[model samples]
Structure formats: C-alpha cells, structure tokens
Target: MSVFETGQTVVRRDVHRSGRVWSEQALRVVADTSEVLVAACVHGAEARWPALYAKARDDGDRSVRTEAFEAMAAGEWELAAAVWQETDLLLWKPPATWFSVNAFFVPEGDGRRLRNWYVNFEHPAHRTEAGFDTFDLTVDLVVTPDLTRWEWKDEDDYAHVRRLGIVSDTEPGPWTPPATRCWR
Candidate 1:
C-alpha cells in the first residue's frame, strides 16, 4: 500500500466500470492514513468533467443535467476543462467504504465558513498512481453545516441511472444515513 504525503497534489478520478474516466479533479492531500485519505481543493483548482455536466452547471437546467446522466449511461461523452468554483472542498474517503463525506466551505467576511456537508454514496477508492479512483452511484446526502437539516440529493437521478444499468441493485450494501450517525 502506497501513502501520499501531506500537501501533495493528487488527481481524483471518477471512473466508469468500463474503464473510462467520467471526470477528474486535482486535490491536495490533507491527511493520509491506513484507514482513510483526506484531500482538499480550494476554488480555482483544476478539473475536467463531461461536457454535458459542465453545461448543466453553467445553465442551471435540471433537464440538461439529466441529459448528462443519459450520456453517461450510453458511455458516450466528452470532457471539458473546468475549475472548481466558489467553494473550498474537503473530501474524506475510506478505501473500503462505499461512501465518502465531503465538506464545502464558502467565503465569509474575512475567512471561509462551512457551507454544507455532502455525503456521496459510491464505490470504494482504488489507489492509483495519480491519486485514487471511484465510481459515483449518483445518490448523495446533503447536510447543513450544523448537521441539523439534511436531505437526499439526486434520488431521481439515482433511479434513472439504475434503470439505465449504470448501478446494480446489489452494488451498495445496507447503509445508515448521516442523520443517524454520531458526528460528535
């Protein structure tokens, strides 16, 4: 098992089961241990995403985003260069876990403050030379910074992906929501 040093630049790749990359983002290693890898990216970090996905972000059209998923389902898409915008991101990934916890920070008066906590249910991390790889299952949980208010994100999309055979019924095991977990 290889370990990444703190402050090292690593590329996180979202790979499809067919061995194609869906997206790639650069992150700086925050912490690395046998249990998990922690990484962070500030606004302006480099990223490459499916063109349709980038369109969805720029247009704010839900239908366009849905179209992106459709593209993914067909395994036909193009990558567009993009930059992480407006938020600082901290990602925590446990190699064998089926999910990852993410924290997004937005600028406040002089510094930044936690905007929200996001939990992405996905395949476990696979170590790579650049950084790591994982497949996003499309479903996620978004929690308020205080962890008081939370909601499921992209459930309809999850269903759509499942119907398109992007995710298998047995891919994820029984899991608990963040609300039910002990954060403190």
Candidate 2:
C-alpha cells in the first residue's frame, strides 16, 4: 500500500506575515510507493517575486541585482530569485532519520527542457491520513540538469540555528560516536 492514496488532499499550515494561523490545501497526491510519494499543488501556480529582483535576474540588470543582494544581506529572504516552479513534487525516502530529498522542477526560458533541479534535504516526513508533512532542516542543494555545477545553500543558517538551540546536534538515527582518548 502507498503512504498516501492518489487524489488525497494535503494541507500545509504555516504562519503568515500577519502572525495568524494560515492553512492551505497545498498538495494533492498523484503517485505513491514505498520509495517515494509524488504530489502536485492544487492552488494556482505562478512565479511570484519582488519586482526589482525579478528584473535583476530576468533582464540582466546589474543595478537591480546589486540592490537585491544588499536586501538579502540585510536579512530579507523574500528578495531572492524569481522562481517559476513546476507543480509536480517528488519526495524520496533514503532510509535515514530526518532525511529525505524533495525534488522540484523549474523551467528555463528557452523551451528546450526544464533546466533546474531543486533538492531539499530535511526531516523525514510524517504520513498523515490525508497526506504527509515534513519540515525543512535548513540545508539544501541545487543543481543543473547536466550536473556541471551545484550549490550548497544555507550552511551558515543551519549552524546559526543549531548554535541558538533551535535544532539538535545529536545524530538522527541510532549511530553514535566512540569515546575519544585525551592525550595531553
């Protein structure tokens, strides 16, 4: 049996900018098996972005790009790239605790093929009666379809959150380190 059945409704609850509980029927399960569960967003899919940042990336405008970088340095997350993401979702379970790879497709402009692959490694999902849910663990990897270059995003954020007692340092599974000998 699959973790979630096809056409099942999945809700994602998050805090909105107004500080209220905002819940949306985010995903509908498409395919499910022991290894992976695929879903698609039911809501209207569009590329949302800050206007200046979108101009920066899409128009090759250096001035806007500089402004966006400055805004990001000032700790604004919403000022990043204009993401035209595909609706399909792939959740892969790799037999590790608090670890799964969520993959998504982002289309590039030329109409050749979808060129961007975004993979997120985060806590293993909890399968609910409706669907499944998982929280992001901060570390993520993005790559091109040709595998020429890849970027590791948010290592500093992970370390900062860990230091602030937000996330645990303990390994997710049963494995532990052996005792170290002190040689002074």
Per TM-score, the best of the predicted structures is: 1
Q: Report lDDT (Cα) of residue 63, candidate 1.
A: 90
Taking every candidate in turn, the Cα RMSD to the unseen true structure, in Å, is 3.6, 9.6
Clashing pairs in model 2, backbone N/Cα/C closer than 3 A: none
Over 1-184, each residue of candidate 2 has an lDDT whose tens digit, in order, gives 3366688766433222233322223566666677666666522433334455567768877577455434433444352323444434444554334654455544446433544455665556565565544544555566666667766655555554455443466525321222332211
Model 1 agreement with the true structure over 55-131: per-residue lDDT tens digits: 99998888988888889888899999999999999999988999999999999999999999999998889999899
Runs of candidate 2 with Cα error greater than 4 angstroms are: 12-25, 42-97, 107-113, 171-184
lDDT of each: 0.89, 0.49
Candidate 1, superposed: residue stretches over 4 Å from native: 175-184
Backbone-clash count (model 2): 0
- The total number of steric clashes, by the backbone 3 Å criterion, in model 1 comes to 0
TM-score of each: 0.92, 0.54
